[model samples]
Target: MHEWVRRGVGTVAVVLAIVSSAFATPQSLPQTILPGVGSTSWEIRNDGGTDGGPFAGVCDGSPAFGFDDATSASGAGDAYDGAWSVWINGNPFVAPGGLVDVTGTTLLAGPVAMSGLNVWLQYFFSTTHQAARILVILQNPSPVAANVTVQVPINFGSDSNTTVGHTSSGDTTVTTADRWVVTSDGGRATRSIPQSFMDQVLPRWSQQVIRRRCSTVLLETVSVRHSTFRCRARAPARSCFLPASAISPVRAIRLQEQ
Candidate 1:
């Protein structure tokens, strides 16, 4: 009886290993939740469960943006890892037994609803520029006021260089821009000379610097708790031979009572 039990255990282990290998061998593609409409496109990996977010690739001819969990500025997390979440009432948006429903499209709107927090997130592409506009609304149905912090992630990449920076646009507004420096040799250069103009002037090459801007606007008062926020991110076209990768960073803007 002991020998028979040992043989059965070994057989079960072998079967489990075979099953795991079979499932691991095939890699699935990310779901293109938001298909490319005109010049814009977006995708997400639903199979990743909680870790699923937008894919890191071209979105309307610009670098796609996602979520970053790292708090430090220098420690930028993976751009395509997952979508940003909210901290509500001094707690994470999704509770231990909470539910998250993500549904939307590129043609119209994509909405992510969190039942526990009673928050709705909707995103769409800009018609004028190659950018995404995200709208976050919090409905504080609870008796007490809720404090929420919406964290966004910005990831930009290109064949030449990838860099992101922030600057204040107004008293209550902040702007995040991605800078790309391109040279003739397909590498980043400190200074770019206009090859078209330089070839005629001195037969020398000039590097080109391109900057794209994305803005985040807080529509309602943050102190009040029950309010709305609008974040507009756009990646305008650049005057470079190759398509420049530009993505905006996530900015925390405080809204005033209105």
Candidate 2:
């Protein structure tokens, strides 16, 4: 297995990810109970770019890593179910949405120097009556923030097979392209994909980093729990169901037919 390494620059450190071994499966990330949990696996050091600038690395050691939110699954343990690793600039970005497409010859970031290998990227996404949340986990030891984007496919699936998912918005055309960023402030950084973007895309989406490459640190996982409660009248009690109040008697009240 290729071991990812962090080489420091002026102040920013470039993630030197070693190519992943063929046997490396999606199970490699950390397991947690939260709906979506993950980790970035790379050795840390200090020697590529400065603390405030960009840096690059030799993509021959290990795969850099990122995380995606869960749709059907919940907690860190469920992250491996439908995860896929997408490469941008030779770095591994785990899909937080689901299946992503990168058929183009080049990446939006640039000419990545990958070793023509495959790596596992993990992710998940979901929506309900409440707010939509996208949980992202990435490994970066640099001082500057790395810009990241996730593209989710907004297909109607069987609901409307006749219609293509892509739509046009004014001068800007909307494909399965959705985007977000992950940054470090001398510590760990967590990013949330907005609900608005999720509502606008096809059924499929991929994660992309626009400008920089990241190395593995530790696997980071994210989970979202939403609940709504309604108040109801108390029923006739075998025992008193309500709390004792100064205005009410101490004895349990029995209902009588009028």
Candidate 3:
């Protein structure tokens, strides 16, 4: 588990996301949660930009990552999910939002480039899990080998806030999981590699970075936890499976209700 101690968290509203077809130009962003009805819920965006936004959010009834608040800096929501931004050769991949489109259960976003590496995020989701499956499609259209690092800012619970002191935003947690990230409130979320996807490593977490404002640091820790991959010149779009369950149709990842 992360060994640093900083306490903060705030209220996050729940709203249904907008699902749309492909768009030629960028649109606006709608940050909310359609975490399903009753026991199922979700947090995906179809705002025009930041489309297919958050990689993790309220799955089932528990929120493992991300906060749905348009009042935040992003003006739509704050996604603390891992892979928030990708770093190639220490440079971040940035593009104006509005390039997200979800078809059925699969999500496609980006095509951003940094250091001659082009990156696309293909995410799969289920109604019962926080983050289902993530396929980071990497290709060097400019033909360059790049050291790719998935920059992830983790939160045990996005909804875990308190008023005990002058601290209230990005609240700290009080438990551990061998395979998942759990909060004292019984909320859970975790990341792992799929057995079917070979040559892929597990994800790495920060043992010493602050909770919300992760300015700089490598995503991988010393332990066997974090994930990073390499891209050769003109390589095919590689598939990296960020699994939630043990291959149950890539179903039930992210946050599942107890």
Clash totals for all candidate models? 6, 59, 28
Colliding residue pairs in candidate 1: 39-60, 104-110, 192-206, 192-207, 193-206, 193-207
Task: Write candidate 1's Cα lDDT for 1-258 as tens digits.
Answer: 000000000000001111112121222333333223343333433222222222232223221222221111112112222343232222223212222233343211112233323343333432333334333444433444333334333232122333212112222222222111222112322222110111101111122111111112221100000011112112211111111111123333432222
Q: What is candidate 3's CA lDDT for residue 257?
A: 17
- Model 1 bad stretches (over 4 Å): 1-39, 47-116, 157-161, 164-258
Name model 2 segments beyond 4 Å from true. 1-132, 143-258
RMSD to truth, every model: 22.1, 22.6, 16.8
Per-residue accuracy of model 3 over 100-200 as CA lDDT, tens digit each: 55565555566665444445544454443332454443443332223334443232222333111111122233222111221222212122111111112
Candidate closest to the true structure, highest TM-score: 3
* Least accurate 10 contiguous residues by lDDT in model 2: 232-241
* C-alpha lDDT score of every prediction, in listed order: 0.24, 0.22, 0.28
lDDT of 3 at 16: 12
Higher-TM-score candidate of 1 and 2: 1
Instruction: Using lDDT, give the best candidate's number.
Output: 3
Give the range of the ten consecutive residues with the poorest summed lDDT in model 1: 4-13
